[model samples]
Target: MKLSALVPLVGVALLTVVLVGGCAATEPTPAAPGGTGDGHGHIEGATEMPEPQLRLVTLDSAGSLTAFDPATEASVSLTDVAGAELLTSDGRYAFAAADARLTIVDTGTWTVPHGDHSHYYLAEPRVVGMIDGGAGAGLGRAASNAALTAVFFPGSGETVVLDGEALGEGEIEELARIEGEPHEGAAVPLGEQVLVSSPDAVQVYSAAGDALGDEQRCEDMRGSGITSVGVVFGCADGALLTVEGEDGVEFERIPYPAGATPAESFANRPGRPDLAAPAGRSGAWLLDTREREWTLIRTEQPLLRAVAVGDSDGRVVAIDALGRIVVLTHEGVQATSEPLLAADLVGAELPAGVVLEVDASRAYVNSPSAGLVHEIDYVDNARLARSLDVEGDASALVEVAR
Candidate 1:
């Protein structure tokens, strides 16, 4: 089947005509009698072709962001923002946090979900806007429920949350400017309420900065991620799971097992409800928000980063100090990848910069030390597919599907 060419409309703000590739009007060629046509007519057992499956967004050490389309082997440089690191996406827009600014890039692609399949579209991608997050801007996160994006500055003890509508309209509207003690803090948007980190708890505030409900106890909160079930925050004792209830918001603390060392941070798959973190010296923790269960899986290697993927019986993809990728489930180690990153390098320079981007079937591991991204087919026993030389030191990597 022939795909249609993307034609950009003139005088439009990064807009393109949305057209299906093979849906153009054309005359049907005559088919041979009593025989199936090769290319002129409908063939038996034909299925809808899959669109370009994924795109990789990389933030280089220099803070330049580039979106690479592997299907077309095309790369688009979005912007150069200094000190950029954390990259988060809501499957629509990419929010990259630099030193004191939040750069928003329009991915120019999105997916519309159907029951069994999804439709993909693409347009002219561009750097939509940039928000001055003030000094020490870092930890970036996005929430789809309230169409909000947040950036927290640990050095300044300030958190900035922006409304999605304002962003789409090329305006930066601060939903909340929260000030608190200087510590590793995080924020999450829940409709009209914003959750900001306090010294000993998580405090809720209105978009207009008015205090909402009483602060929820969560000592030394650090990492956070949103899932379909709710918003979760990792604390000293355990994790705080918040969900929308009939009355309002319901909060529950899923304590770590007795005597289990507390994990101060957590990371979850973009849309999954399960979260993973480093439990102890050699243990990986999994928290299922939907089930309200926490499971500790022991690992032989000391893990540096762990991301929970898959549904029930989900797996945790972690990178150890030796730069090896380990896939573990609740049972045990499921699969392991060869050391794709350099194990040497010391102190802060250690190839400590590693990011895992995973989808249903594959996981993309980026190693800045090697300047390469190893694509692994997770379902096929963690078989390495391709080691793509991205040709730069990537501090962050995120997978975008269209």
Candidate 2:
């Protein structure tokens, strides 16, 4: 295991850590057990630290926007965008997409996880505005559980539903917008209800919109995330699983293991239930979701991005296919890194704002054609834990208040 090198956060183009909270623990950030918003876990001005204060919110390729501090690499700029190109976050709002246009930024910092402890806050990062989203959009926020975020456009089936306590007081409020039938879809917010993804059924709602019916069939429901043992949707033939059950949102499909090959997307580290996708070229596809099972791992090369750092050495942080940074587990390939995006590997294609992000220890990887941001220490075997220096082209990485 041995990992603690931590010093990869250079001049910064973007970064986020913000753990903060170590004292005020009365446990109040729990309203969305049914899901909507009753407290974005607490945010009125923000400034309550004692522990986690690590932040990094980068986004470049000309859309600038910083916020560093991998541990005193101190940085801050936070605003700028002209054609963003995809960057999403729920660890405290970062969303930067650029085609269907979505700009919100507010990395003031956050962490709200009130089960036994966790409250962190740090306010003063601005720019929370913009949203035309509906042409492929696809979000599903809840990094640390700050309820009610889901975006999901799917070229316009529309499911916007924000209002995680009015985005923690910066405001965007729209607790529901629901609509369906547009295909290429997927949605999630399963607490007060909201599942969406209809062409085989998945629908279910009521974050203040009400509809709660369809109970999981998933035939083509594109990708989706949010985990802690629930809300996963990526079905062409498998994976539907929702959670909040008290006679409400509860589905489960999981299929696909025979011919396998179905993980268009899914990452982890946020309320992880062990998920890491990209099993196409025969590589990483962990997906444990509390043992629903699906462990592929393969990787000889051909990955581009994989996360799932359910640490303690279950690590699975890939980026192979010549871009190097491959550190898997389940007993195979322990470390490798030297290509570092090997000039963004043009052959298999790699740009959708490539990311690798994971945190709780380290694993940032985002070279953007060599602008810098490696920082991997995946149990020290994937080692390199430093290389941050980004002034431009980190392309779009999200780490917000992790």
Specify the highest-TM-score model's number.
1
Q: How many residue pairs clash per model?
A: 0, 23
What local lDDT score does residue 174 receive in model 2, on the 0 to 100 scale? Answer: 78
lDDT of 2 at 66: 81
Where is the poorest 10-residue window by lDDT in model 1? 37-46
* Model 2: CA > 4 A from native: 1-89, 93-107, 110-147, 150-163, 170-193, 196-201, 212-216, 219-232, 236-260, 264-276, 280-299, 302-317, 320-336, 339-355, 358-398
TM-score of each: 0.81, 0.33
Model 2 per-residue lDDT at 324: 83
Q: Which residues of candidate 1, in runs, are more than 4 Å off? A: 1-53, 111-121, 136-146, 343-352
List model 2 lDDT by residue over 344-370, tens digit each: 777886787778888888878667878
lDDT of each: 0.68, 0.72
C-alpha lDDT of residue 45 in model 1: 20
TM-score of candidate 1 relative to the true fold: 0.81
